[model samples]
Target: MRQWNFRYEDGEWLASTVPPADDNLTAAVETLVVPFGENLQAVESYLESWGRMERENGFNYSLSTPGAVARRVSKESVEICDLYDQFEDTRIPEAEFISLLRALSTAMRRGT
Candidate 1:
């Protein structure tokens, strides 16, 4: 399975399983557009909780298409699900997902 990762480069956010050496989303299998301002605050809150909304409920962020979402599937996993069958879902460990988001958030803040 491909290992998922995220980054912010040239003022755009990227999500992919590409290696850090690539540094671009050209090969990304999935992408999520995250806007600025209040959305950043929401991201911060999400980061603080690691997308855990409640005891049984977690987080679900839409992808580029309808029904496609990055969902918190378990205490240790986050899955990018394509509900319309356009593509296969991808899963990443929660710890790694949080780390990727944290780094991307910092990079976004630094304008890097």
Candidate 2:
């Protein structure tokens, strides 16, 4: 059997190890692995929390999509509340949202 170790780079997938296929993924995992993103229940909780946050932030857009994405994120992995708080300032501007997201994404990587 053959096994492949995957690493994501530049918006694409990369295989670092070309090993014989085996039942085990490997002796160890260098990057972390999770069967699920953030647990469903956690995401739900985050959604509810975000709704309350939206009210305070004045961001009226439907949070349904963001809530869904939150499902893929571990609650403990991200301080979603922090991002929400930043949104409350309004001074960040729409263009800066992407920068904030990038920072938050980096934070997730670090926390994970």
Which residue window of length 10 is worst by lDDT in model 2? 27-36
lDDT of each: 0.52, 0.30
Residue 80 in model 1: shift from native, Å?
1.2
The stretch of ten residues in a row with the least summed lDDT in candidate 1 is 21-30
Write the residue-wise lDDT of candidate 2 on 25-91 in tens digits.
2211111112114234433444456557555655433232321222112222221221222221112
Query: Per-candidate TM vs. native?
Result: 0.54, 0.23
Clashes of 1: 0
Off by over 4 Å in 2: 1-91
Q: Candidate 1 clashing pairs?
A: none
lDDT tens digits, residue span 1-105, model 1: 334544666655656654442322222223433444324665576565543453435444432323345567666777766555555667767676666656556
